[model samples]
Target: MSIIIIGAGEVGYNVARKLSQERKDIIVIDKDEEKVERVAETLDVQAIHGSGSSISVLKEAGIERAEILIAATNSDEVNMVSCLVAGVQAIVPVKIARIRDPEYASNEKILGKEKLDIDLVINTDQEMVNSLLRILDIPGARDVVDFAEGRIRIASFMVEPGNPVAGKSLAELRKDYSNLELVVVAIYRDHRVIIPRGKDRLKERDLVYVLGESAAISQFLASFRDRKGVAPPTKVMIFGGGNVSLLLAKALEERGVATKVIEPDIERCQYLAQQLDKAIVLKGDFTSHDLLEEEHVREMDAFIALTEDEDRNILLALLAKTMGARRVIASINRVSFAPLAYQTGVDVVVSPPLLAVNRILQYIRKGKILNVAILPEEQAEVIETVAMETSDIIERPLKDLKLPSGILIGAILREGQVIIPRGESVILPGDKVTLVASSAAIPQLEKFLMVKLEYW
Candidate 1:
């Protein structure tokens, strides 16, 4: 199957890189020669320096043979036009666009099946805000992803030295906390990801991903928190007046939280003030340490840096943490900057591009694949998929299935009940199973799901 990706920007580049690694036929189109060159040099895919919305360029990129077309340009108009042109020129089965404009996103008729026929519309800003809210809901979690309609959650937490589960093996933890309904799926330590086993030990500063029912996950996470009890942030100070910050402020306001936004641009601040009813908008430079101090940054329950500047966001987040803010979240656009930001003591790093890529992957992997959540740095993914009758995984106990090394069955949703799988657990056809697989093991996983040939 041929896939045509428009725009060689972060989102487009990431999607192309992933698909190319999976050995899919990918062709990238970008008007910018430099970005097109970068994609051609780095990825084993065809790159064309041409406008995505141009009919000639679509033909040059072989859109007629493309099974999937992804429009990820920064301009909403360009993205929409690319999809329309693809629909007109080819029988592309799926067209996904990254739409940022609220006006276009709110109007279903404009992008409906009768109109644009877009298979999936990704709103990066809204997805980022929702991800932030989920992280905020779980106070100490580094990342949180919901599956099975929020019944199952894959939450990542940093294992502190003093935490109860810090130095314990998964087997010991299972014996100690026998009633807890959570399973350790993956562990990230020293920039390496480990598909954890029963004997694997969780170390300090290790980012551990656990999967289970919502309540069980909460009970499991409680062990990572201190006795003082971490409460949800009641007061949030956002350091940008962009669309994402505005949306997040509005959501927080609905939850009755005191939200404040500081922006350097006076006009933007004025616009934000007019748009927001309860959230306070202040016109000031985020670089001014005195201004932040004057606003009692030390007393804030959470400090968020959502500015366009990645360096500024990381530095401000670190400064906020140093100023005694309870939690600091930074919006990083570059995937390479996340580990460094985390090393600098930033509580959480949210990447909009990565979030967009994750959403797009869900649609690209058709039938039986219900959802996909890509872990940080593309180290791993937690996939929620249904067991198909034609697959070899069903009607047998999990242990006898001869699963690959870097894959773990996190949870099984049968009928309405959630099951934490064990060696004796059997997977039936039509059951929703969540699997955590390392990046190296994804091909094996696709083979097991019997979607290897279908994916291409």
Candidate 2:
């Protein structure tokens, strides 16, 4: 599809780079000639200089030929107006607007597709918050990817020396917990994605990926938990009150998780205290070891560092890890700091640019089927698809069905029992089947599972 992206910022450039790799024709527009020229020179894309919201600028970029128009300028007004203009004048089939203002996000009537001309709205803050909380669920997991309406998940965690999973093999695990239905896909051992065979044993510091029902993943996690009471609703300790922290704290509280925020700014802390009830807000410098210790950092099930200063967040997250926090997550906006954060004791590292890239990628692919969600770290993809009544999936049992390789049907939420399929399992109309596919087959994953129905 011919794509035109506005704003030659890092987020815009990253989106163009990713889409260009897929061989899409991309054109980027930016007011600053320097950024436009720099991005065009570095990436395989066209550069158009002008304010993206201007009608003349849209026309010059061949918006009429563009299948998708993305307005991602930092300003919410620019993004919304640019997309509206593209929708009304350029006849673009899909228009995605990057909204930065948090207030506009809550006004669903204004941002909703039915009310606004925009087809999609991207919110990086909300996406990052979701990622932060998700990474905390599995104590040692560096990454978490949810599928099947969040019912099935794939998580990757490092097995340290004292970890329970460090000395176990898949076969032994199955023999010991025969009722549990979880599959280990790959292990990052000796710097490679080792396809674990039945005899392959988990070792210390090995990063392993496991796929299973959400409950099964929880059960598996329970085995490794240091001491389990009634599984606490993720007690989280955050080290900043920046936009990311505020958004994350609100999201956590909404999910019934306890959030404790430590910020040095008294005014921000007071604001947070007024805005959030489920979260405990504190005004103190988390960098001070005494302050962190007094706040009971070691008792926190999960610790996140989301301050604007990447160095501070990284340093504090590492400190929390050293102080015996089970999970440590840090938000590093700079790509350079990403490697360092991961190398340090921080368990999970999230980069805004990467999250923005994934969001834009989803916005561009609108014609295939129903909803699409790409898993973090490019590990997996979860798509909600409707199986056609005439499709082969309806006639034969799943075992007899010649399903695509590297793809497994995790669950069939047909009228809601969440059936973990057996050999005789069959798909019917209105049945929502959750599938897990490895990275290699993600592009063609949906093709093998559902037949896209089109109207005349």
Candidate 3:
């Protein structure tokens, strides 16, 4: 299938790069010639310089035969128009748009197929805020991905120095704790990805991806934590009164977590104070040492830096950690800065573009797959796809199936039941299978599990 992405911004660029790696027929459209050149030069995909919302541009970009049309331009109107034309006029099977405006998010009828026929609308701010809270809710977890409607969760935890599971083989842990069935799907050590074997040892500081029941995963994560003596986050400080911070504070307040926000803009601070009932809104520069000290940043259980500026965010996040904040997270918009941000003192780094990309990709691969969560390093991917009747793996036990080398079935959802997969588990036609594997195995798994995944 052919895919046309409108916008060479972070979100579109990433989606193009990923789909290109899968060797799909991909074309990117951008009004800016520089962006088109950059995408054409860096990524192995065709790039066209034109306005995506224009019918002439779509025709020129081969939207007539394209299967998926992603409109991720900065302007909401452009994206909406592009999708409306693609779905209604051009008949593109999948239409995804990264919508940033909060005002446009409401009014379902307008976004519905009856009006715009937009298949999926991704609110970047909302997705980013939700991801931030998901990571923050679970302490010591670098990444937390929920599936099966929150029944199952796949969490990535850093094996710290004093972790009980550190230096232990998977076989030993499973043998010792028979009831603990949380499956270790993949391990990342020193920037290398390992589809772990039973005999493989978990080294200190290794990032372990475990999947199972939410409660089981949570309890299992406890074994990998050296933070038993440390207090859980109660009072949280957020720098930036942007939409994400506002939404996060509202969520935290509803959960009864004491939250405080610091924004330099006086008008934004006033708006935040007006909207938030209980959360404290402080007007000051969060990057200032004096401001942090006067606000007692050391007493904060968690510090989240979500300013628009990445450099400032990195600085404030480091300052928050140095000032004794128990947990620190920073928002890095650029994909290039993700590794550097993680290497810094920040505990967790979230990218809004990446979060939006996941939702968009899920929609593109929908029905064939329910949803997908991608690792930043592109080392591993956890996907939820239903076992189709045409799938060869169906009607057979998992162990008996000839699966790929790096892929492991994490869970199966059948008849509203969540099953932690095992050797004896069988995959039925209608069952929803959650698989975790190296990025290299995703194409092969998707090809077999999804019906008629025709590629150009």
Model 1, 264-283: lDDT tens per residue? Answer: 99999899999999998988
Q: RMSD of each candidate?
A: 2.0, 3.7, 2.4
Q: Rank by TM-score, descending?
A: 1, 3, 2
Summed over model 1, clashes come to 0
The predicted structure with the larger lDDT, 1 or 3, is: 1
Q: Whole-model lDDT, candidate 1? A: 0.88
1 against 3, candidate with superior TM-score: 1
Question: TM-scores of all models?
Answer: 0.95, 0.83, 0.94
Report the lDDT of model 3 for residue 440. Answer: 80
**Best of the candidates, lDDT:** 1
Candidate closer to the true structure by TM-score (higher is better), 2 or 3: 3
Ten contiguous residues with the weakest lDDT in model 2 = 447-456
Q: What clash count goes with each model?
A: 0, 0, 1
What would the per-residue lDDT of candidate 2 be over residues 185-278, giving only the tens digit for each residue? Answer: 6676664555455798999978877766777777776787666522644688888888888888888888788789999999999998998878
> In model 2, what are the clashing residue pairs, if there are any?
none
lDDT scores in order = 0.88, 0.73, 0.82
